[model samples]
Target: MFAKLPLIDYQPLKIIDIAQVYCTLTHPHFSNQIITDIDQEINIIANKSQITCQQSIPKHEEELKIIAVVKQLLTNLPKYSYPKLSLKFKRIISLPGKSDQAIAYFQTDLLTDSISTDLIGGKLNLTYNLNSCPLYFSLQSALIRQQDHRLLPALAFEGEFAYGNKDPREILQIINNWSEDWLTFKEIINQGFLG
Candidate 1:
């Protein structure tokens, strides 16, 4: 139902390959983390919409809650395996139809990896080889496990990996750096502790 809506500023993502029992080419943790975040937002939206009609209060509170939840989810995510990211994203394919401008492909692409880091979130900092716009991090998330069960601090979110930077030059650097370890890439970009 929320397929066409753009709740976040970025393009809407389809949380495919949730790894019920296994995974394919995609980075298991990163892909699942992305899915977790998206589903979290969906849950918030659904809950608010379900009860908003019953209550007279505006949905600003629910929106804030959703944001807070996302932040916490980010905080709880575990770090990525650095070099493993580039290898995992061996390929990618997107197919967005009219009105439904969304990506519907899996595992494949042909981009030279570069690297970059950002001080966007204080000192935590994220580093990546920009191949698929990586955004690595570390966390202990209480996310849903396989078999529809649950687990505490299950190393949710792949910790790093986004779709591409807004700039092509910087994006190039990010992708090119994917061959290096997280520590090397971190030092190259001068973010913080790379290990």
Candidate 2:
């Protein structure tokens, strides 16, 4: 799904401070057994909206361990209905010329009856900092109304990478890697957000 989107490759960039990947599932029930089944090494947080497992960057060899945990969670989910899945990747890049930094936010959401109708899609907002003289840009897809009264099978990738003091190409490379990993993760579950 990400392949179809435009690639972000900007020049004169710097470092990435944060990288986050997340997904949402449609399970309304909670199971303690499923929680127990996860490896103790991963951090699992169960909330009203969803169960989230998060981990900081692991050693190169431990990547598979993280993937394994994600797969296990998906396998335990109920198969009766479609799940809401979302993947987010974020980084902070530094700019050499400016004392202040810029921020960019991007996101897309499917408009369903469950959501408010006033929401708009494809939103972009920019703000400037007078002290540091930096800019912040926010980009997002408007809420696309669903024709049918059901929740549209869709996935949204959102968030922004902060512009810091590292190489721009390298920051994009990291984003690309994370995006590819997300694609592989989706394939492992044999599910696509947009069916």
Candidate 3:
């Protein structure tokens, strides 16, 4: 039998307090040294084996613009690391017909892709039915290269916490737990696929 993970105590926080976060990590081979200043909200880091871009306060429309900028930067590079891309966004949401007085938890596998004798990649959709509302979480990852659909390295995760809740302490705790689990899962993927 396996032991269950310990849950953290609830700490209330306003939705606005949680800044919108975006992260992208590519394979080492695709890493380059060209850095372009996009804006104050965006931060770019270029290393020998990877290029990472993080948006502090990301907007829906800005996603496309960011991707375009990344593509343009990639063009300047002479070589490509198998072309792996990962995008993640997190925000708060609201659900109707859900009571804030109930406690529930649900999760399911949304999709999966694998290779022989190994779990290559997949996605998991989760819902936390709380007393105030339901929080939705979507995580998607793959090891396939975007250019030719060949296997590479990639991962993404998005968590949407329900808004309009009277109390946020419980929700914050849930988010904390989910984030811890996500970190562990990411490490596994890093070792298995990106390593």
Q: Which candidate number maximizes lDDT?
A: 3
* lDDT scores of the candidates, listed in order: 0.26, 0.36, 0.37
What are the root-mean-square deviations of the candidates from the true structure over C-alphas?
20.1, 18.3, 18.7
Better of 2 and 3 by lDDT: 3
The RMSD (Cα, Å) of candidate 2 is 18.3
Give a tens-digit lDDT track for model 1, residues 55-131.
11123434323323423432443231122212121111112232222211100111112311221111123345554
Candidate 2 vs candidate 3: which has greater TM-score? 2
Candidate 3 local lDDT, residue 146: 35
Q: TM-scores across all candidates?
A: 0.20, 0.36, 0.32
Q: Itemize residue pairs with steric clashes in candidate 3.
A: 28-49, 29-81, 30-81, 93-163, 99-131, 100-131, 100-132, 101-131, 102-131, 143-152
| Candidate 2 lDDT score at position 48 | 43
List the candidates ranked by TM-score, beginning with the highest: 2, 3, 1
Pick out the ten consecutive residues of candidate 1 with the lowest summed lDDT: 48-57
Residue 185 error for model 2, in Å?
Answer: 15
Q: Over all chains combined, what TM-score does candidate 2 have?
A: 0.36
Error of 1 at 63 (Å): 38
lDDT of 2 by residue, 125-155 (tens): 4443423113243333322223564222112
